[model samples]
Target: MKIDENVCWGIIGCGDVTELKSGPAFQKVEDSSLVAVMRRNEEKVKDFAERHHVKKWTTNASEIINDKSINAIYIATPPSTHLQYALQVLKANKNVYLEKPMVLNSIEAKILSDALKQSRSKLTIAHYRRVLPVFLTVKELLESNVIGHVSLAEITIHQSKSANLIAKIADNWRTNPTISGGGYFHDIGPHQIDLMVHYFGEVDTIIAVDLEKNTVSNDVVKGFVQFKNGIQFKGNWDFNAEEDKDNCTIYGMKGTISFSFYGDEIIIFLKGKQERYQFKNPMHVQQPMIEKTVGYFLGKNVNPCSIHEAAVVTQIMDVFCGIN
Candidate 1:
């Protein structure tokens, strides 16, 4: 297959995330351009295009997928539409930058997997946290044995009904199971799960439970993950909690390291001493991953995150929510 020399990009869902987290980075990356953007709302999409300096805007996704000038398509739509739009892009022979929680469920992932077998187009999941400096530092510490013989990881992600951590969206589709696949956990858990698998290894077994299942969405969940490498993970997520708290701590034989997934600092404790590492996120938090994705689409680097790896996250969440 001939590699595309430059990645002319098109965005399928130019929503709030695109405003600063991702849309601008496409223009900032070398050999990449944000040529077009699409949203169901013509006014919003046109406004986004004008503000971002993109030349084209549309309400129809087919325009972006079928545009020959666009070698890569970024699909940031909700989880329910990921599989459909991704299949269309692949059929058009265009590379895809798919958002995380890759599909509504594992069944959709199976369908996407089958479609991928017949297409030469490449697809990368947006588990963007993998490329962040704070996460990279955590990986480095584990590799360097800064926290020796790591045995366990404990997580707490408690938030009230109106926590600021949850993205503000109209109609709150993120909390609707039919649209987001699960609940708030489904919306944000993919990154946490992906990071764990990235740092520890493949999952060996999963035991989880949710407080409610008959409702429109399940908000409270408890899960335990046992990685093949002997590292264990225990977590609790309560969207109806009274306060907001986000923390993850890894315990090891020599010491312990703790940090918040949404924060910019890592604290380490050992031998009666403590060390803290801080980081500042870029204006476009997703730029690092987008740059890597552009290189990957142009045949310069490997995929930042693959569909198969991302499926594990959905699969794990399925068990956590008792949907598997």
Candidate 2:
């Protein structure tokens, strides 16, 4: 693929994620340039633009979307605003790189999907796990049948409340159902679910046991999903736990594959031996996502997670949230 060397980029929201990691990634990616940024807070927008050396900053999101100079727009805002912002950008004929849990519900997902179909602009969701080296290795190993005929898989994610920034924000968007859809599950579960579907193919059925009282989310949740390939998966998310563990184990007839998110490494046990694979440091996984998304937009590659896959994920999450 020939690099265009002239891809101008704009960030829709200058939030913590953009400032800490994604902003730098956009600037660092080859053939990509961060030209503009938008935020509701004028001072924050100006500060971010100055700090990042962006050419333009505005509080009006439409300015970035409608700007003919910008070829791609990154929607780093919350899930609730994703659909609207994406549609507006698509309408303006700008490529979109949206954050995960693409929208609050499947309906919004469909709306965005339909808009993308009509517009010349392309869409890519921020499922960063797909581009991570360790996870990519896992995908390769599974494809190679290292774990012959995966039968069952389990994923457990535990995090301390002390580290939860969303919990500390007064009237945080993440806690509000209108903004974030649900709580922890909707916020972070998309990564796990997307990875599961990415490896195992489409899910045939899903049954969720959400323990929260007000339809937000519980400290613990257990879900069972059956994939079309007859692979059964059990997933759990525990937010109120003291010790943190983010790992997934896939079992098969021949061997097993295990991975830890914190370590960014994979462990494989096969044929009476165990081996480990470690990924590179300064693991800016988002860079790959940005590159691929740009490729997809420029008709160089396919959108890895299509609307159908995103809709399936939304359906499963809705069932988990007990939303009809």
Candidate 3:
């Protein structure tokens, strides 16, 4: 089915993410409107619909999927249900915008791959950093050779020790492998892997080290990734660390470039000179990408995040976690 002049949207599992970073932005985009929202909690769904001024709310997935008014569906649920919801939407002839950590394992990712191969419907993942202003600048600098030929890069993501301690309680979905796929690594690793893959090509696994957290979580994960172009990536994600930081640094012939994944600060060092750049995030962080998705639905350009690009990250995580 072709996109209509207006891209009406329906959202599934309208949770915390839909509250700030994504929901309102759907209506703010030109030629796009949030027509329907769904969640298991009837009260929450009604509240979200009223707050966002969305026209419809429901507790059943099929209601929105069958609604001819909605041409696109956003799956905002946990990783466990992403594939299940996405297949129904696609089979109903609607485009999809999925939250990251695309699916729990490579097997799920492959099912999505095979489904897309036989359908004309489109899909985009929520790797929003792909279009953020600061990241776009970093991409520009890398392409312009701000740091000669890139050789080695290092990345670290650390959270205060107490964060996990607080989350280890009963029924915390973030720590449950059945629901979250893994702990903080599976949850936050997608952003890092997707961004790295955006700059370089596919990654080959060198080695991965895993450490246990309380029975609920895998607190520490470190790995070495090598790109076909010979660039080396060394990364560590520790949720039980003493400090809270998210940083990535790239080393090259001329100098080094450093920045944070969730922060606005970016620094470049070259030829005895150091330059720093800072910016604020948009009120709704996903607005830019949402606008782009609206454009794609309208056939204005190619999708921002393709299934193939997203699958690579999932494949890497599956291998790293030994999910096979």
Model 1 C-alpha lDDT per residue in residues 27-129, reported as the tens digit of each score: 9998888889999998889898888888999999998988878888999998999999999999998989999789998899999988988999988998999
| Tens-digit lDDT track of model 2 for 25-83 | 88887677888999999998999999989889999998898887888899999888898
Model 1, global lDDT: 0.88
Clashes of 1: 0
Clashing pairs in 1: none
lDDT for model 3, please: 0.85
Query: Could you give the candidate ranking by TM-score, starting with the highest?
Result: 1, 3, 2
**Residue 148's C-alpha lDDT in candidate 3?**
99
Across 8-83, the per-residue lDDT of candidate 3 in tens digits comes to 8999989878899999999899998888999999998999899888889999989999998899999999899999
User: Which residue pairs in candidate 2 have backbone atoms (N, alpha carbon, C) closer than 3 angstroms, thus clashing?
Assistant: none
| lDDT by candidate, in order shown | 0.88, 0.81, 0.85
Best by lDDT: 1
Give candidate 1 misplaced runs (Cα > 4 Å).
Answer: 1-3, 210-216
Best prediction by TM-score: 1
TM-score of 3: 0.94
